[model samples]
Target: MGLNIKNETTHELVRRLAALTGQSQTSAVEDAVRRRLAELEQQQSADEEERRRRIRAVIRRAQQLPSTGRTTEEIMDELYDETGMPR
Candidate 1:
């Protein structure tokens, strides 16, 4: 397979990386891509963990509130009469 890298800067970077690492241009590109993908995946995993931590904190706070312990019908009685008309 062939890759078409039209950007001069990107082409130069790939060439430099290959020269520095003493590898072929294809190998340099492959290693760079893999390393970047690993970094992004790790970052995404950390973000997900932070999101879950926030959700758990919210749930814990909500649980600390007092419960009414009243059923829906019992509560509705406060707003409606026996004929189901609004009070």
Candidate 2:
């Protein structure tokens, strides 16, 4: 099975696709649009997984931290520094 996108796309976009790839205008536009959509979807999935992992890590760390309390920002800063985010 395959997915189909239906809409009116600009001729200039089609032309640019053709120029960038060496394919016919229609084929270039179709391929370029398909490739870009696939990349965006894959990146979105990766980002969602990363976000979930971060949230879970935060939850676990919060449970372990002292009840006498540090701010959320402080906890996050500690995690970031520990992860060498500024490296």
Candidate 3:
């Protein structure tokens, strides 16, 4: 099979690659482009899953909080008692 890709690419760089590795510009460019795309897809999938997990944790914490809230001073006193904070 043969690959034909036509776009703006550096001719001098292609010439140097052909001289060094005896492979055409199409082969080298195709391999490099495919690898880069694979890397991007993997990273994007991992990032999306992490974002979803963090959002779920935040939602769970919000759901556990009481609607009938204590005063700010009462909340601070409770926190201080729990942690043995200084007056």
Give residue 80's lDDT in candidate 3 (0 to 100).
81
Per residue, candidate 2 scores C-alpha lDDT tens digits across 11-77 of 6777677888889976886787799999999999999999999999999998997785688778778
**Distance from true location, Cα of 10 in model 2, Å:** 3.7
Worst 10 residues of 2 by lDDT: 2-11
Which candidate number maximizes TM-score? 1
CA lDDT of 74 in candidate 1? 90
Q: Return whichever of 1 and 2 wins on TM-score.
A: 1
- The Cα error of candidate 3 at residue 68, in Å, is 4.7
lDDT (Cα) of model 1: 0.96
Alpha-carbon local distance difference test for all models: 0.96, 0.81, 0.77
In the range 32-51, model 1's lDDT, one tens digit per residue, is 99999999999999999999
Per-residue error at 20 for model 3, in Å? Answer: 6.0
Give the total clashing residue pairs for model 1. 0
TM-score of decoy 3: 0.53
